[model samples]
Target: MKTILFKSKLIRLFIAFLIFASCSKDDESSTVDIPTVNYTATNFDATFFQTGNSTAPTIDWNGDQGTFSLSAPLAGLNIDSINGILSWDKTLPIGIHNLQVIITNSAGQTVKNITLSNPLQGVFTGFIINGNSEHLEMEFFSDGTIIVKLEDSGSPPTAYGTWTKNNTTIIANLTNPENGVQASFSGTLTIDTTAKYTGNLYSNPNLTDPLGVFEVVLH
Candidate 1:
């Protein structure tokens, strides 16, 4: 009877040990819970235009802290990985460029498209005047300042003035200090495969009589 009781107690101890070991193994093999990522806001649908100078628009984003990356590398743009701030100190090319922005965390990833464009605010050379090549250089500043220089013309051939645009109609008021000549130009800007602008030059601010029609193309 003593031997039987001892064996029964030993079996109960073995069973308890097995149950504890099984429970430990199950606990060790359990899967860890990962946090789900949720993006509250994103600037993916925003349109950014490249300024002629070193200034650029800022991209704002609000979401979970994750990694940020661009689909392809841009020439002069910089993107903040952790904060999602996009900035650039130089101008990009003209036309529409689609950028894919990717955000990823331990949970998942989110992707969106960002459009970048450069309008007609840069240095344009190779002016076509009256079906002839004038070989002039025109620099359009972002601050509405325009500077025109004659490539082959002699000294004091530069004109400095202010320019304003309403839609496709561009109005420029320029003055030449050498000859005290005030010139105004009115034109329409069209952007296709290249930027082509056609307009007429006038002498007065009212833009009464046309002097000559000119067209310029951007490279």
Candidate 2:
């Protein structure tokens, strides 16, 4: 009886040892869960997935989003620092837009890219005079034309000229023979929804100078 009791105790200890060894092996081969982020956009979408061997990622919110129009604090663009999710509120423009996001994880820093396609093309109409007492107002045409209308001076002058827009700049030159004046004006124009240019003129020039900014919202 004594021998049997000793043998039984030895077998029980051996079984316990086997179980402990199995547990330790499993613990060493186990995998940890990594954080992942995702985002959705109507015009474009950007998704970011964390690596399995890395910890949380750090986000640097200071970066140029490669935008010429969507620039403002209240703009419809924002990024989540913790998750690296990018979102846009309103419609995108009609051109291609590329945005960059940098994520630093335990493994290393990873670069991400986002694309906003078919951005909402916008059109605006307005006039920029010399701001002097010439009273010279030229009409900007979508077909790249501008008509110079000299108030009621009765003298017809060179009222049409060529202009161009480089993303956000406007350059136009016109003459007011009725007022005996010729000048060129250039400035930054904004989308003025409060006013609209809807008058018929007597001249047409070939130039697509950006007058202002107006979005084409799909209602």
Candidate 3:
């Protein structure tokens, strides 16, 4: 009779152990980790624009929906708390500025680093070689405008266009006023004391046409 009771108690304990193990397994499987926050907007990390740019850039977030806040109050910038949009109304200073954004959600909080700047606003003189080399001057304006003079003899600009910089890469899109020929100059800046920008000139914006190499120095 004692053996029977012992056996019955052993069975009940085994069944209770199985139930507890199953419950623990279910709890472990049901756990979900927090998703990491990331930037979803285009041109948010490092954006370089000319000074007095009326069109402002925005910073949008992805992953967990959250509240947005800046590290400190920027002088010429504004941030939307709910939507995570950063706007500029007043004129920003003409130099590189580092910024940080803090995002807090139900899951967790994170910080992001960003770089904004107004750079490369000066006259660049160089030569473009297709069949023959021709002297040219490219003047980058403070308002995101560009004037390309085919001759360096103090002549008027032969084409007008816009300029933008991305990191160390500089891009200029120009259109001839007389013949409507579109061209683009895209190059990487040389990391030397001379501060020379060297690249090729494409006959079209798609950059498939193989024009000769060109080099320019900022004056």
Candidate 4:
């Protein structure tokens, strides 16, 4: 009887050990490894133009195999799930847009924020006619800052200014750096075949008695 009891105890111990080992293996197999997701934009700051129809940018993605989708329904924009790419329609509004892209895999999901900007921001070159025609360079920033410089043989002076747009109408106020004299400009901006601005410059703050006419096209 003692030998039989001893064998029965040994069997119970072996059974318990097997049960514990099996539970450990199951727990290890159930764990999921999270994935890392990232992407690169072809355009700096992911900026795009609304000049033509069906414009898209190649966005290189790096990560585990996953599905791509937009966090929200972005108007005038679409994305491909198989390969992450962003395409824009010409109907995209002219402004700053905050967008989010979601990537999902069996491990989990990650969301990335992207900013798209479409602004009348560039260097414009043309001529300003006062008494004589002089070449001028005007730069418009998205933050409403304007830099005006006259191109000449010597180091021409630069004028710092602020500009505002109301529909197609544009108003700019500039102060000469060399002298403290202030000037104002009012114009109509056209963005059709090209970005062109035609305006009149004034020497006075009130914008009375036009100084000259100017035309500049954005590159």
Per-residue C-alpha lDDT of model 2 across residues 1-219, encoded as one tens digit per residue? 999999999999999999999999887665322223233432353111111111223333232122111123323456555655455543222234566655544433445555654322223333323222233445555445566444435653555555555575455566555554544445444333222223222221333443322221111
- Which candidate wins on lDDT? 4
Query: Using TM-score as the measure, which candidate wins?
Result: 4
Query: Which of 3 and 4 is the better model by lDDT?
Result: 4
For model 3 the local lDDT of residue 190 reads 58
Residue-level lDDT tens digits of model 1 in 1-219: 999999999999999999999999887665333223233333322222332322222333332345777879875566677655556533343335577767666545666666655434677666636445566667777567998775444542789998887655988889987888888878887654556667887877799877777776654
Sort all candidates by TM-score, best to worst: 4, 1, 3, 2
**Global CA lDDT computed for model 1:** 0.63
Q: How many backbone clashes does candidate 3 have?
A: 0
- Name the TM-score of candidate 3: 0.46
Candidate 4 lDDT over 63-142, as tens digits, reads 34667788888666777775656667644545666878776767777677777776657788899998888998888887
Model 3 CA RMSD to the hidden true structure, in angstroms = 12.8
lDDT of 3 by residue, 87-109 (tens): 75423433466778777766566
Model 3: CA > 4 A from native:
1-96, 99-116, 152-157
lDDT of 2: 0.42
In candidate 2, stretches whose alpha carbon ends up further than 4 angstroms from where it belongs are 1-9, 18-22, 25-30, 33-76, 81-84, 89-97, 102-111, 117-120, 130-186, 189-219
Per-candidate clashes come to 0, 8, 0, 0
